[model samples]
Target: MLEHLGEKLILHVTLGNFSFSFDILTVIMSWVVIAVLVVVALILRRGLGQDIEEKPSRTQAILESLIDLLKGQLMSSFSSDKLARELFPFVSTVFMFVLVSNWLSVIPYCESPTKDLNVTLSLALLVFVMSQLLAVRMRGGIRYLKGFLEPYPFMLPLNIVSEIAKPISHSFRLFGNTFGGAILVTVVSAKFAPVLVPAALNAFYGLFVGAIQAFVFAILTVAYINVAVES
Candidate 1:
């Protein structure tokens, strides 16, 4: 296990003369997370088939609180309630997916998808693209373009560089934290203390840190949207 600390299982395919290498572990783990979320969503949807309840069940109460929390974060940044309502599905999904991905480490023999740079970077890029599109939508194209030159004409290049750095920084922050936690757990568990130590570390890193990182990522995504529209 120690020998394979950072190694990935690659799946290679050849189509005619071209060959493609894919990180099979990351892909598999990512899909596992997605499938789990899908199943949960289906169950929840079926539950919704019941008549509306005046007083919420425990599960419903918890879910409502979570929704309000995410919505409140969006509403705080976006003054328009309609915009917040529209954006809730996306932001909430992001939070749930990431939170689940991070928590994957808690399961025995399962690793978090976020431990892979590709996964985190892809997520960051998705948010980056969405933010750019939102900016263009909320502030007209001309105004959005003009944002790069604000305060001083010479600031355009710097602004462009800043925009380019967002995804890089966003992705690396998550990748580093999750990957580092994984490595820490692996190394300590393999070479040092046994069951109890590893269990404690896994709970702390996989659950607590995972939840915090997910929330941070979601909040940063919302912050990017706020900057996009209000910049």
Candidate 2:
């Protein structure tokens, strides 16, 4: 039953251990996303200036607005503390990457990298490890273990288990939503004839879902960092 369902939804492509399988449209969409981001980065780097007289074009204005928004969100969560300063770059990069990937899937032949279980899982694991390491560093070895004690000693086991589960839930939530959207769009496009209608629908889906997922992911990162860094 699982195999049948997967066969109906996914388009598998294998090349040795390096295999890529997803909705065909999503796979193509992912590439488009990567290309667009690269182009934007290059344009910004070229156009960015030392002199006050150098002015930004429309692309620079858009990029600056996005950066400002992300920075503001990060500041809200962590304030201007040392930890916030340290973590801001990593968190901002993750947000932009996920946002771009999610939005890319709205294009006819593209898919979000967040839709891939491997990608989401890897990101979650990175966050998990980083958080734990920060906690350990801040509190030292024995005190870090003592963090679970909180109000009562009996809750230690449960607290430890909950900490372990956080990454799993974080990764699955992102991957599931993105994959579901990709599958839905693919099915709709296939069932219809001319692709313009489906493309328009995809644009809306990408706009709404992409922004929400990016915000959620960034919020969770800030929360996790706060938990780890605060006593």
Candidate 3:
């Protein structure tokens, strides 16, 4: 049923003292996403303005708007434009990747990678590890570890739990939203006879919800990074 529903496409490989089972569809979709992003990046790169007085093209203007919006979000998180611009590439790419992947679910034979718990959880873990590493690198290991003991040592356990909860929340938020929407759309289209209603619902589910969730995820990630570094 899982395979039939396109939930997971499994394949296995083994090596010395280790083995792995992976989703082939997710692997393919991830590559597709990366390819799309690369192409967009190239187009944006070519569309960049070269002269101070040159009028910007529509693509350039749209790209500029995207950058500005992302920069604003990052500045809100970091309280510094310099820091936001410095971090924009990583943060903005995360937003774009998730945004594109989530929106792709509307196309036939394409599933949002977020529909798989493994993909979302892995991304969450990446964010978590990056946050902790940034905190440690900025504060030094001793100070970073000591941070949990601050405001009285009794808060240490709670702080530890809070840090661990971040990735869990991040993963589940994206997974639940995307997965539930996919399930609902599937059920509605399968059980009902209406075409227009289902199409509208799918558009809302794919475009609006997908975009909002992507934005939220990116914003939360920036918030986490800022908190980690400042702590």
Candidate 4:
């Protein structure tokens, strides 16, 4: 258990003069999270094909509630219903992926992909790129470029720096929380009472903190895109 704190199982590959390496555990856990989300999405799709019932089943209720929740969040940020609907799929997918990835740590012998900086960074970069592309599409390329010169010409450098920092901060925020929680849980389980204390802590950190981090990441993605497309 103590070994789980900071150690990483790294795999290296080499071909002639080229070399590459990656964290094996993070890669496998990420695939596992993706597989879980895919299965759930299929289940939801199958459920949707059924005829409308007078009363919703548990699965139907849960699906409707989750969709409503995500839609509400998007609507709060976007004044245009069409725009909100357009962005819903990406934002909701991000929320589900992050939530599932974060929760993976709660399973025995399984770790969260978000605990790895690479995984979180990839997700953050995806959001950043998507927002930028949408901005350019909504605003002309010249207008998008001109956004950096807002208020004063001298602010261009500052604006550029701020834009660069978005993915860094976004990725690190989720990575720090998830990684720190894993370390704390491992230490408690190894040093203190292994059963009760660790279990309680895992529940709090895995479920509560994980959900909050996922929500924050999703909301921030929406907010960033909103800012990009706004005049």
> Listing every candidate in turn, what is its Cα RMSD in Å to the true structure after a full C-alpha superposition?
1.7, 4.3, 2.2, 2.0
Per-residue CA lDDT of model 2 for 68-186, tens digit only, reads 88778765687447877788788987787788988877654445767777778888889999989988987797998788897689998888888888889888888887777766666
Clashing pairs in 1: none
**TM-score, prediction 4:** 0.92
TM-score of every prediction relative to native: 0.93, 0.79, 0.90, 0.92
Worst 10 residues of 1 by lDDT: 46-55
Worst 10 residues of 2 by lDDT: 1-10
Better of 2 and 3 by lDDT: 3
Scored against the true structure, residue 217 in model 2 reaches a CA lDDT of 82
Say which prediction, candidate 3 or candidate 4, comes out ahead on TM-score: 4
lDDT per prediction?
0.86, 0.76, 0.85, 0.88
Off by over 4 Å in 1: 53-58
Ranking, lDDT, top scorer first: 4, 1, 3, 2
Residue 167's lDDT within candidate 1 is 88
User: For residue 43, what is the lDDT in candidate 1?
Assistant: 62
Candidate with better lDDT, 2 vs 4: 4
lDDT of 4 by residue, 1-231 (tens): 575458788999999999999999999998998899999987877666366655677777778888998988755787557778898888898999999999998899998999999999998999899889988999989999999999788999999999989989999999999999988998888888788899889988999999999999999988887887886
Candidates sorted on TM-score, descending: 1, 4, 3, 2
Ranked by TM-score, the better of candidates 2 and 4 is 4
Q: Name the 10 consecutive residues with the lowest summed lDDT in model 3.
A: 1-10
Error of 1 at 31 (Å): 1.2
